[model samples]
Target: MIYLQLFWEFFKTGLFAVGGGMATLPFLQAIGESTGWYTYTDLMNMLAVSESTPGPIGINMATYVGFTAAGIPGAVVATIGEVTPSIIVILIVAAVLHSFRNNPYVDHAFYGLRPASTGLIGAACAAVVLEVLTSIQLVAQEGGILKTAALTLDAAAPLGGVLNLRGVALAAVLLVLTNWVPKVKGLHPIVFIGLSAVVGVVFGFAGV
Candidate 1:
């Protein structure tokens, strides 16, 4: 039953999340909230891993979530669920695309979708930025709306005191290196990614 539920949930996400992998973040976040299968932090981590690895982010995330929930079989089911809609849609599109290539309605529909996809992707990017830049967490308090508060690394510190300075520093370094330094700007993105990983390790060890 859990496996079936996982498949169905991802199928819905695949069906509606039309703007590519990043756009699926909102749906995945909602799934975490509704199913108790994962948390927002887990989703963020999943996004990181999905982006770094060699597959579509949405499928990678589904596999990770499913495996965490129910092991290998769950991973297979979740992946199939995530890709099934795309497969069906592509088949349909391929068959009808030539016939409707110049149809006004089809052209207008695609034009409308472009903006919608852009908006969804933009929203996802904003969410990622907020998650990385701020140290806030949402908590539900009794008889009230959700409360927002900063997270502290040390228990002794006051609330909203601690920030992920390491992340900020790394982001700043990468931005400067890629944008300002001509030598570094010419390097491939993979080089920067490798350097960032090493820096992350150093910061991790330094308790940053």
Candidate 2:
């Protein structure tokens, strides 16, 4: 029953999360809230680990979440569920794409999808930024995104409780290294991700 639930949830995610891996964040969040399987912190950690290692983020996340929920079999079922839709859709698209390649409606549909994809990805980015740079765990505790968001807007909130200074510092440093530093700017992103992992380990052990 749990396995079936995992498959159904990921199947829905894969079917409707139209843009790409990053675009699935919103659905992933919804799944976490609905299932009580993981928390927002868990999702962020999943994103970090998924993006840092191997294949598509969505599939990786599905595997991780499934494993966490029901071990090995759940992982397999969830992964298959996540990819099944893509395989089916690709088959359908391939069979008819040649016929529709020049159709005005098809072109317009693709054009329309671009903005929707951008918006989904943008929302995901905002959510990540909020999680990392701000202490918005109230949403995790109470499941009130609107309430926590409103709290963030309060000018009189205590600084120490509102901002994650270490996260802010790390993000600032990474941004500078990636965008401004001549020697570092050209390095592949995986290099930073690896370094960040090492730093995270150190922070963890040091109780920071």
Give the runs in model 2 whose Cα sits over 4 Å from its true position.
1-74, 94-98, 137-149, 152-159, 204-208
> For residues 1-208, what per-residue lDDT tens digits would candidate 2 score against the true structure?
8988999998998899987887788988998899999999998998889977888887898888888788999889988988899999999989897789999998999899999989988987887898667756434335544544344443443454677666677889999999999999999999998888787797762244
Instruction: Name the top lDDT candidate.
Output: 2
Candidate 1 yields a Cα-based lDDT of: 0.80
Clashing residue pairs, backbone N/CA/C < 3 A, model 2: none
| lDDT on C-alpha atoms for all candidate structures | 0.80, 0.82
Off by over 4 Å in 1: 1-13, 16-57, 65-74, 94-98, 103-116, 136-163, 205-208
- Error (Å) of candidate 1 at residue 200 is 1.1
Model 2 worst lDDT window (10 residues): 149-158
